[model samples]
Target: MHVLCTAGHVDHGKSTLVRALTGMEPDRYAEEHRRGMTLDLGFAWTTLPGPGAVAFVDVPGHERFVSTMLAGAGPVPAALFVVAADEGWMPQSAEHADALAAAGLRHGLLVISRADLLDPELARDDARAELAARGLGSWPAVAVSGRTGEGLDALRTAIAELVAGLPAPDPDAAVRMWVDRAFTVRGSGTVVTGTLGTGTVHRGQELELDGAGGRIAVTVRAVQELGEPVETATGVARVALNLRGLPREKVRRGDALLDPHAWPSVVEADVRLHGIGGPAQVPDSPVGLTLHAGSAAVPVRVRPLGDDVVRLRPDRPLPLRIGDRAVLRDPGAHRVVAGLTVLDPQPPALRRRGAARRRAGTLAAASGVPDAAGELSRRGAVRTGDLVRWGVPGPEVAALAARVPTAAGWLLDPTRATEAAEALDRAVAAHDAADPLDPGIPLAEARRAAGLPDVALVAVALDRAGDGAPGGPVVRDGRVVRAGDDGPPAAVLDAARQLHADLTAAPFAAPDADRLAALGLGPRELAALERAGELLRLTPDVALLPDAPDRAVEVLRGLGPEFTLSAARQALGTSRRVAVPLLELLGRRGRTLRTPEGTHRLR
Candidate 1:
């Protein structure tokens, strides 16, 4: 299926051309028929010989309704640009032509309508010249009379040929259908109609509706195409979705139904305007304009970056991507101000005084194409999925495997990898200097020190630093450790050795707080010795050898299976304070069990 929108001046017979081709009325409102002019968007479709089904979105062409015309034409890929023979080229014709060019529409058929009223050959030549001036000279022209049906067959054939040659859209792409017509059906609830440009929509598929009120989850209760209910609908086809979990008032004509996880609602972006050698010029900085894209017309504040580049900050968040074409209109003048091609949907902030001017130079050099490596380099690192949402194709992201390194589902720039590795080395050295007893840095702290987003990236930085290199950073257990370094400093180790000697000589003589402090064992040093398996801490102050519990159990077994705390202390030759917690620690280790009466037995 193929969908095309009608564009031309008001009363240029755009709707008439659609009616003649489809044998269906293009105008839906009574006011439109009574006034004999298109006031809003009208929809009709017909089955072509080779194209299967071709849908037409008839848009109003009056200068007042240019916004309405853009809403219809923005999402459709091709167009049926109509111009009456009697009125070869009109004001709305130039505006619509500029709009279509601004929309980046390359596939279309120029229809010279009402040929019976005048000689269409002359009109066709004149219309072709006018279109050429507006950058649409490549489209095929057809002379047809919608009233008398003159040359209708040729027009249909031209449309079929134009649609058959259009670039195929990916049915597997992410869905981002803009709602051109949204209303409530009698019993089906809210129904939104739009031309699906890519991806497929199926019944029961959950989607996110992004609008002025922010994002909300909605389910597709049903899908319909050409007035027939269907299990699924693909791109380049007109679809009417019966949506559940939303009211008619909430779903507006400008809202979009997007794959919930595939789009990011953004408010600011850097863009290349069709400024130089084009019909429109970039407006001055901080000027108010209406940005039209994909059936959405949002008020925006434009900051002129260069002669042809700008940064647009929309009043509301929009689902935008790089390379997407949009129109910027001066709402006060009611005319197109500029046409834009998005360069960066996720632009950096212009905080410094000259940042905007400097950024303009950078954007001028950008290719305005989806570049995974370029984006990754700009951000240093980003989620793989985020690049996809930024308009980089999944295949391109996968192909970046050789150019970019991924850690914890994030793509890391080569330069950033080097920076993070150096950061890791500094962090390890700092941590070791600050606390020699426990030198290895915690993984979370290492991630922060390296300025990496994820803790898992610390390992990647370690690997980048040549993890096992002599004295280089490496991860031991869960902490980031320096390579080739044995335990604590020599002085701390000497103190630990003396403590070990004391504990070995008297197996159960746990050191008191003052004694341990005298031996230079603080909480940190003691915990380090404990982690090294050299000592066991029965309490904050009481210390013992790692095997003291085993030797104590043997001594208690000599006193029979059960013994009182006092008897145990006497047997172990330790004081009551040290004996109390030691007995409790033995029970906790399951080497001994405590009776209800507070006597203990070996387990």
Candidate 2:
């Protein structure tokens, strides 16, 4: 199955031709029928014996409904361009062609409707010349008159040939079905019709309706193609799914049902805008406009790139991946001013104008190449859809995946990796310059000060930095300590030898910070000493050098296997500051037990 949309001027016989082919009136509303104009979207499907099935999305041709026309044409892969034989060419015709081209519709058939009303040769020549000027010279053109049924069979044959050459849709990729029509059936619950662009939909599969964060566990009660029931539907097929859970009002036209995990709910994108003629000349800062992609329309603030490009910030959070094609329209004039392809769907930061321009240049160059995914992955992970929007052929996307660089399942850019490494090296050098006495800066603090994105990137940088020299100081938690400096501080070393003698003579007590300060050890000195791997400062007033507490524990355990805080204080010859912290540490370590009764016992 193939989905195609019609575009041309109003009263160009678009609806008449659709009615003639499908034998179904496209004008659904009484107002449309009475006014003899298509005010809303009209849809019909036809099945040619040899060509299989094709769906027609007939859009209103008036200039006022250009936005509506865009919404219908945005998702279709091919189109049927209608031209009235008498009119030849017009402004709305050019606008429709420009819109189709901007939305990236490459395959189409030109239908010269009302051919019987004009001289056959003149009409043929005129239509061909008009299409050729729009760069659609190779498109097949056929003449038809809905009133007389003249040339209808020939037009059908031409349409069949055009659709037959189109690439078979990929059902294995992520499912992205754009809803063109939604209605309720009397017996059935709610039926939504759309072109299934990718992936297969089975009878009872749960799929998420994107743009609305809503999940409908649909039991595909029935499937239809060109009005006939079918068992399964694949990509390129126009499908009417009889959904189980959602109501008629709940599901609207333009909603997409996509693979929940494969597609992101909200993506930050980098877009390169092609200025309408050359570039928009704005003396003042650029203003915001609405960007239309697929069935989703979002208001975006445009940040211009000197003269050629612009960055867009969408107002509504949309489920757009990298490589999506969006049209930026001037909401005030309601004219499409530029077309854009998403580069980074989730960018790191929108900072540094110069850096953004450089990145944009790289993306533009990559997008113009034959292997966009490979080029993008060589830089970083790019969404597969982004590669398509960049104009790379679909078959090449999988081939480009092999070229991506991965480390522990995370993709990394070689250039970014190198930059991170250099940044870390600079950080270490800066730290060494500032704190020569310390072994090295703590890894956590180094990571914070270096201002890199992740710890893994920092680790990669450190590994690269240590390639030439002996390894620097070891890092534990957030602390940096020199290797082999696990002994007591020099001041604490002297104090420990005396404190141990004092504790042994008395039995279970230790000195406080004031006592250590009296021996020339202050807070700053103590911090340096701790970084040197010396004494552990248990509290504001309490201190312990290694091995002092261990000996004190043994003396108390041997004395009576249990002791009171008062008795322990008397034994170690210390005051409450040293006695309390020492007992608390022992209790915390489970080496000695402490009770609310103030009794201490060896565990």
Top candidate on lDDT is 1
- The residue-level lDDT of candidate 2 at 143 comes to 84
- Candidate 1 matches the true fold with a TM-score of 0.90
> Which residue pairs collide, candidate 2?
268-345, 322-386, 323-386, 509-572
> What does candidate 2's lDDT look like per residue over 1-603, in tens digits?
778888885762889999899888777788887777787888888888777777888888888887778878888888888888877776778678767756656688888888778855665676567666555667877888888999999988888888888888777777777776788899888898877877898777667775454554445677886677878788877788888877778777657777655565554566665433335332233565677777666677766543545566676556566567667776576566766666555555656748766765655553523366454544443455545544456677656545543333333455554565555556656766675445456666666654544444455444444432444333344543333334344655575566556545654344555676677656655566555555566675455665657866866765587788888777776777777778788888888886677688888
Measured on C-alpha atoms, candidate 2 has an lDDT of 0.67
Cα RMSD of all models vs. native, in order, equals 2.9, 4.7
lDDT of 2 at 38: 80
Q: Kindly list the per-residue Cα lDDT of model 1 for residues 1-603, writing each as its tens digit.
A: 999999895873878888888989989888988888899999999998988899999999889899999999999999988888898888888888878887788788889899999988887888788778767889999999988999999988998899889999999999999999998888889999999999999999999999999999999999999999999999989999999978999988889999997987888999998842354466765766899989999988888887778889999999998889998887787677767888998888899998988988877677779898888877778888888998999988988855666777887877887898888888888878988888788888888888888987777766765746888888778888877868777887899899889888888787777888899988888888776677788876678888887888888888987889889999999998778988888888898887888788888
Error of 1 at 454 (Å): 0.8
TM-score to true structure, per model: 0.90, 0.82
How many Å off is the CA of 114 in candidate 1? 2.4
Model 2 stretches with alpha carbons more than 4 Å out: 184-191, 212-232, 241-251, 265-268, 274-289, 331-334, 348-359, 368-410, 435-445, 467-475, 479-515, 570-575, 595-598
